[model samples]
Target chain A: MPFTSIRELLPKKDLVGFAILALIIIVLMPLFLDIFRLNLIGKYLTYAFVAVGLVLCWGYGGILSLGQGVFFGLGGYCMAMFLKLEASSPEATAIQSTPGIPDFMDWNQLTELPWFWEPFHSFTFTLFATIAVPVLFAFIIAYAMFKRRVGGVYFAIITQAIAAILTILIIGQQGYTGGVNGITDLRTLHGWDIRTDSAKYILYFISAFLLFACLFAAQYIRKSKLGRILVAMREREDRVRFSGYDVANFKIFIFCAAAAISAIGGAMFTLQVGFMSPSFVGIVPSIEMVIFAAVGGRLSILGAVYGTFVVNWAKTSFSESFPELWLFAMGALFIGVVMAFPNGLAGLYQSYIQPWLKTFINSMLSKYQQYIPAKFGLGKPAQEAAK
Target chain B: MTTTHNHKHKEMALYIEGLTVSFDGFKAVNDLSLYVEEQEIRVIIGPNGAGKTTVLDLICGRTKATSGSIKFKGKELTRLKEHEIVHAGVGRKFQNPSIYEDLTVFENLEISYPRGRNVWGALIFRRDDEVRKKVHEIAEMIFLGDKLDSPADLLSHGQKQWLEIGMLLIQDPELLMLDEPVAGMSVSERKQTAALLQRITKDRSVLVIEHDMQFVEDIADRVTVLHQGKVLSEGSMERVKSDPKVVEVYLGH
Candidate 1:
């Protein structure tokens, strides 16, 4: 029954878009790219998760959270802590001052591991903590701000402040969080060797699949009545309120949901990339995530994945050759995106490419109308009308 | 489901007593007391800054009252939030048309259907037969039947006003508050709106803040004349127009 109504859930345009994105991610990318490049794409796909979340929370909900990297970092740090603990087991770190403690703790002359790190020793606890920590943090922030009706630029500024504070706290407290270098030397996840190229390939597929799942969830949200209400609230909040909708609760829900989705990506980043760092937890990366959403057309869910890929790919290639010019080029890309195509690549495609594709397909169908008979189950009913 | 709004034996659908809202030093609505009986079309007319719209704002929870008791069907509305007030069967339309411009006329009406208002409820809500029937029913009521699929931004000023009214009608509120429902309307549109208001107010009480005297005379079952944030006269339109204080404050030089 549910599958029968699934067609009504998404429009034909969105269904086509989802199918195309699925093909590229699940089939074409893995087949075409080598292991090394596939790993790089895996890393980029992690950011795509954040971008998809931003599309729901920011684009549709009119919430500009410039600190999504905070949730991402929290999730990553949770997973990284567990992996680091596994790597620095008593048998593994026997030469260290504290055999069972993490190397960073031992290096900083710590005699014992912290109490909070105790639960992280359990993989199950760490797995749940990865999503739970970020979700709880996001819930607290969203509830307080939205309940008080502090929104728009104020919300963005507060979120950015949180990102900055988390980064500073992480870097300043070296022993607990691996300080500036972050939790490195991550070797295994429950005795499975993750540093191998085969593991990287497997992890890439996992990451891509998870990213696509998040995209589907976001697409569902975008096509739902909740999505329309979000757009209505974004445009005229007072009107929505008078329409008997609890506007703040909706805002809080979307914000928290976005946080959870982004957290999953963060966990995947740690698993695939083998480390978590404060470098990805600060203002710069947080703003860059928003750019990924914006460059894809903030309203387009699948466009976010493509946007992240395009931007990150350009960043990687350009930085390798002209490292100094990469920042300038990135700045130009943002400016060009805003000034030229305010709706991003998706908007450009919708305006120019989609109509042409429709016309081209229609023309071809009509041109072949004479060749295919009505009995062949093709062509417009005009051919049948003639018969 | 509606809020626990009990009509009881109370004659008034809406009852406001000693309602006062002071912004800084000046009181926008000063000790204003008004009542609209069930199914009554109560029109409020006043000079500029007479707290006409402020009364609606307070009753609808848009503006907090400095001191007052606003009761709707015997339920206290002072502490309720805007949406809570709406669920209690009070719907408000602003002086400016407030329909979602990006949405179609049908979409606008469907949103105000008083169901699936929660975050999760809206996500799973289908445009089923019931919702479609209600949306079309409202579209026809507002004379927007032919333009149900057209985006609301394409509507004229009068049509937008009707669209907003239609949006409220979809909610099926027991107490409908319309602020300047005919302000930007043409003569024919104003007449149409008057007829529309009369038709809609058959079962529900309507509180209209109208400026046009002719429009007021056409639709008002009773009139409350306000001056300097206080009621100057209260009677039928003919009686209020005849009141010397009302004429001095509202119509005289």
Candidate 2:
């Protein structure tokens, strides 16, 4: 629940010490690498942030929602729209405002700003739009499906359908959304020095901080009653339902959480990349997010981060080098890991690292059972578990 | 003249009336009517495919009843979902030791407390001291106190059953419906399990569906024999053993 081992390693009392450790490490990032490399690393963090929700939804919930990219796209579009509007001077606010057309569209023959795109021009409104839209969509869909008790393969099909529809809508809305090309080009975060090296580093820090926060939040929930119910739904849904909990509410809540997080991650990605395209938020990307978690460790929060980094690193390093079969290589990795270690890399850690750690702790406890008296506290958990 | 329904006169923990479960037209549990009393260790003993589990499935909300009513603790259980039934104080233990085998025996129980069973509650780590103490007490009672730190899969078969029973115990349900709790247990383990069940039955209602008649005889307060998806006879084993119809059904001659 608490990332038990990490929490144990860094107890609440010693948190300050770890914070200082993190600060020192972060400060050293610029010292070891050039500004260009720092930006690259920062870009990676944005991708990791975007993948966080997918990890929770697919890895823990087993929903296999193939439409998470919809949220990502929404968030990205929201951020891009706000940045684009902010770029235009106040003097340019109402100048005939090209009708039924984006600026790029105006370059063709379109004349007026689509009414739906009007609200997004405001920074604050766009911010809410990004998060609220995705969460709202996810909530409605999850509620309808879960309330009716549709899950497993059927749930998967419905979500994939949603993604397909979203992809088509975004591509076809030539007068509303950016169409196939998607909103892009201009960028700046509230007119801050977006091109500055410090800004890039700042974004990277925020991404890392957000990742840690989400992990912490997920871990807490996993330890809490709500997580147990979800697990119960996964294992014995009927039991949880008879217990008086509305299983639909539980499913919907997690579904919304996943979508909202995915949206925020998408916003971060858009901010970092200075662009948005329909390709970025399609079924392919949605499936890829799930694949990352599956190969890392479905249920482990830390494993999700591990997975996002691993798969992305592979793609970045080798996709272009052997473009003819990069997907083949990626597919091979997925099959290989799933076949050999269903737990993913985290599973690898659990199966291998955990045993070693347990033995070490137990041995330490035995030696210090008296005198130092290791706080192994084994019996307490057992007695409690039996209840 | 006013008359109360004679059937509802008997207060029951579980009231099953004409519970028919049809699979594509064939009756899995046909015209099955049975009542389990509060705290009664009612054993449903029937041969394989006699719909012994179908009854539990219907009761626990695993399988839908085509036409019947199941009222547990005066609440209609037929309409409730599985997890809701669990919260309504009915706990189900599967034939397969259904636990995260990779998790430590204690961790499994840690993740099973009946509190905060919502998505928001799960995201917030709120551990009540009382639940923790109860878990400890259950683990000790189930004789798994020694192996608390060990992963569940590594535990012996008997211990795993004890652990699962412990999980059900933590919920502190009004009724614990266990299926084959001691199916493959060793003689010593069976004896230990029988002792555990006896201790548990003191407080909660237990309905065990077991194939081992000796195990059933060791634990059952009353036995109900089911045949052709119907309640063939209900009485003490000694009395049911003497019933001609029950004998014919069991012998199948």
Candidate 3:
């Protein structure tokens, strides 16, 4: 009868945090940045989607998947395949020996399209495959590992190995995939030129909206009893199992969900950046994505978004000026974060900032309450406490 | 090789037969059989490696038995999974007070409320009056009424033990299996726990594995002494104390 479900989904503190983040992305960035800068921010935001999922999968569920880049790459590749097929029209490739196949296929001396690329010709199938493929991969890994009770560091190593394997497979298969360079030169989606400035601006908003939608969903999960059980399982899995919950199923569910979310981000990355590459589907980027979640406050969805943006911004600036110091700086950031703030920025905010802000707000409210009683012509015998 | 079956067709809470388990080549529990009647408190006493804990493990589906049949209320349980075993009205508590330490005492109990066991059920579960009332009742019973908001890890070792019992109680399981519930508890805490167990066993059965002799005498309706993975003696507390075999294997050891 308490309507706790509604309150849990949109708690006051989280509502404020959500509002501030939404305002920064939707209202401030568009007004301030040019099309080029905004599009870059949009690309960074796509990674935020993966970080958000990591917060759920790694932070809450205690599943450290080091192959998230695999899912992201899978999504990006799915979209890239569709876009590449569209870009490789018979009229566009009339000069090539084979007019219909992708240019990379021409370079690799293949006259026919690969079997896998045939499905992406339909936008509908490509759309579904973008999410489904990554989730299916995640399900296989989760089901096998969780069912056998293989977790902790072993799970991390296996996933990282999978990331390494995927990168090699993508790079080695030069004919079907674009090899080291990856699938690039994507031009349009349903005949709309994605490279145009207007389209870039529109895509940035769409990406921001999708990120917030993911944030809302992640928040809902964290507030529910399922989230608490995940936390419990992370701490003591056997206890949860004896409490009448299938621990493996929960693990599989969260892992697949994380994969699906990361895949969505990957697809959006292709739409904005106009390419899908093996560069994004390797161990390095996958671990980097985890750090984005870690630095943001792995437990906080909104924090992961900010974490991704700030880290990427720093990476861009550092690499631009002092490329040599960038790796060292990144390494130190990770070490410093782990040593000083295990919970990251959100933990710091909760511990040091939130309490002070709460008292400040309470004092302001108490003063306002005195004025309210006076305005109503009621005697202020006892001052009401600001909760 | 005999099951030592007691009340074969009665409304027994648990019945295990020929439950053998081996770790590599060494037998942890060999050809073990156990029974608990409805609304009874059965305590298992044993030396260090007498398979007291292993029997509980087999019943709760933690450790798979080599060849056995476990039945609770005439339903086969050995084939069921751990969660399924719990859903079939059996709850287990580990030796080292395995409550969720990061969560508050209320949340620790709330998770075991038995209604929302599945993923979807948990997502839609609301803390309505019924849930709140039940949690409060269990908290009071466990003497944790004043510490509902306190984190479970912050409580003393004895309090954590009680909280674990309260968690099991929230599920309203027909059979409760506890391993060393008073292993690290204070003498006073042990007495309080003994009283708490007495009150809760009015309508349910409890299978306890304990080492404290005085504590055992206070709560156990029947005592089973185990040694070398087999039952050496079993009867009333006084009857088992007088048995030379039980004294040699358990009391002397």
Q: In terms of TM-score, which candidate is strongest? A: 1
DockQ scores for all the models shown? 0.59, 0.32, 0.64
Best by lDDT: 3
- Candidate 3 off by > 4 Å: A1-5, A370-387, B1-10
Sort by DockQ, best first: what order? 3, 1, 2
* Stretch of 10 with least lDDT, candidate 3 chain A: A378-387
Residue A143 lDDT in model 2?
A: 85
Where's the lowest-lDDT run of ten residues in candidate 2 chain A? A378-387
lDDT (10s digit) by residue, model 2, range B100-187: 5656777667666776565555555455577668778888999988777788889878888888888888878888889999987899
A108-204: candidate 1 lDDT, tens digit per residue = 9889998999999999999899989999999999999999999999999999999999999999999888999999999998899999999998899
Ranking, lDDT, top scorer first:
3, 1, 2
Q: How well docked is model 1, in DockQ terms?
A: 0.59
Q: What is candidate 3's TM-score against the reference?
A: 0.95
lDDT of 3 by residue, A259-333 (tens): 999999999999999999999999989989998998998888888998999899999998999999987888899
Candidate 2 residue-wise lDDT, A45-80, digit = tens: 555555667656666566778777888788888887
